[model samples]
Target chain A: MKSRNLPLNKRGFNFEMIMWIFTRLSALAMYTLLLIGFIGALLMGAREQMNFADVMRWAFMPNPSHVINTNIPDIAPWTALFWQLVASALLLVATAHGVHGLVVIADDYIVTSNGRKIVRLISMLMMASTSLIGLYILWTF
Target chain B: MGITRNVGLMTALRYKGQGPMLTFVLHRLGGMGMAVFIAIHMLSSFLGGKGGQFVNAIYEHWSFQLVIFFFVLFHAINGLRITIIDLLPKLLEYQREAIWVEWLVFIPVYGFAVFVIVSTALGSGG
Candidate 1:
């Protein structure tokens, strides 16, 4: 007699696939983002607009409340902060997705009691690192 | 039925595979490519240790432009492709199309870089 094939539900891998899908998305976005950067680097208008003295002259320009304004660049520090916020928010979502995938992949192979514990410990460490960095970017942005 | 193979003990197991696993494989490969480049960049920065004269020279090197541009172009284009894959899995078949688009975008951008470099070189005697 021939055997039957199992359905997806019946043989489900049951992997809670948490893909830090953002890393891939952001990675890809970041990949080609510099095409326009060639234009940015060539832009000497900023260089032309403000001589070092003039740049220093504008040192007392109005800054937003959040900026600690320690040793940041002269011209719009808040503009830099805006982009940083956007980036770190995406990172938060991405890290969560990554954590999910890591947990699932770990669950798949770790069989022994000690092995499972170690895997969990390592995953948690990596995840905590991702979170801390993400938060730092956000808070300091 | 058109989409159906009869489901019984006699039926063979089927994978409802929507994409060529090759796409999945290549995605990781491309990610790794970007990562290795980034690692080298960070290492160089670390080795250079703050802004010394050597570090400044490396930053300004035209040779590094190739590294910077190629990595940036691929990273963004391949990333956009992966984004589409995640958001719209059905369009995964056209993964190659995305790479082609990347190349398409790369051409003019690279051309302009050449233009800039050439102009800067010839114009440098002043």
Candidate 2:
């Protein structure tokens, strides 16, 4: 397998191999989604008069009389809708691909059988929670 | 033989590996970075509607975002190269060439992204 560096579980290549394959297959799709989403964000940031840096900024400063609204106007509703769709797809694919990658990494460092299982379980849980949150974020818009 | 042991960060930090090994190492590191970024991204999205201040503060800092962006940029480009090599085993013969191609793509893409971000930051007068 191309993922020769990845450590397979004691059970061998069955499920782990599937995930390794999944990552490979998902790469092109994820790359496209991320690229579009990123470019969309850049354009949207411009429309909103916000820079990429503003998206990273946190809500720490005291609020002035007026609130800081981050939503962009419906300058291009269809484009906005399309990107939301892209984001929704990205949320699912990226989470599954990323969490499995983390599991492969964990398998490398975590020696004991039980320890590996624990790490895998935590990873799955994190994946599920984040997927739900991501979907929720998409649903709101 | 016993199960593999964690080699600790000191050994891991050494860049003594070859080309393929370095790509593998960076891919793993980038994967982990993505995991962390995804977690925070989800959390921030959930809270973003309720409040904007915190998210603004985090995004306002160009330097921090640049680091994160670099990870995503490098990982995506290198990953495409790996996927291509994996799917088309014939390309394996040109592994050295493939690595060169990956770097060529990465450097220009990353450099352009940094240029845009820096320009945006400076333009905003932040």
Candidate 3:
């Protein structure tokens, strides 16, 4: 069989390709964070202290406020800086992954190049604001 | 460049592309649905008062739980299947089988989650 190699520039290094890879990695990252949160909650006695929905809320964000209303005696472990960082990372990753997805879907209906650019720009702005708001709540609350 | 025409919702729904098409459409819808839910959740948490609680109340409803869980579970599983196929091109030939497998995995897990959600709601008199 004959083999041909493409030029270096033709390789998949474009913005879209990077985002494609990012979406996959972010999904994996989220699963990891959720697992860590779930295990940590169980270690904290979530099986007895929290209901399924509350445990899910805690696992999804790992912020102390999410579990304050629960029967957990002490919130100190969950209030640790590590979980805050985890929540922050989740916020950023999920926001970027989701907004990029919206942009990709928008491209299907938006045929014009300019329209795509505008949509991308707006998506970026939305992602940024959402992340900022989420991080603020995660860190301060 | 090829000309593009607007696709009406009814027209798009009437198309008969079958299984793959249904999965593709559901995947897009699921992704969008989750994104919207995330936005609402973040904003509500940020509001942090009666206003926030008001928004939270809506999603806390059992019906909302069913819809959101469906989106999250389906999108996550279908996404994993797509990623596996993408990484291992040999699996591309098994796309239909992959989707069938996806549904096989999806139905039971989703059904169990739904059962739990409903039972919890009813148990709590929701």
Could you say which candidate leads in DockQ? 3
Candidate 1 lDDT over B10-95, as tens digits, reads: 44235443343444444445444543443343344334555543654563455554455444444445556667776777766676
Q: Compared with the true structure, what per-residue lDDT tens digits does model 3 show for residues B5-98?
A: 7788899879998878888888999999988898988898888699989898898788998898889888888888877887667778899999
**Candidate 3 backbone collisions, by pair:** none
Calculate DockQ per candidate and list them.
0.11, 0.40, 0.47
Interface RMSD list for the candidates: 12.8, 3.7, 3.0
Instruction: Estimate TM-scores for all models.
Output: 0.45, 0.76, 0.88
Between 2 and 3, whose TM-score is larger? 3
Model 1 chain A poorest ten-residue lDDT run: A54-63
- The root-mean-square deviation over C-alpha atoms between each candidate and the true structure, in angstroms, is 12.0, 6.7, 2.7
User: Which is the winner by lDDT between candidate 2 and candidate 3?
Assistant: 3
> What are the runs in model 2 whose C-alpha is more than 4 Å off?
A1-13, A35-73, A76-81, B5-15, B48-52
Identify the superior model by DockQ, candidate 1 or candidate 3: 3
lDDT of 2 by residue, A100-121 (tens): 8887787776878888879988
- Candidate 1 Cα errors over 4 Å, as ranges: A1-16, A20-74, A77-80, A87-141, B1-30, B37-60, B93-99, B117-126
lDDT of 3 at B63: 94
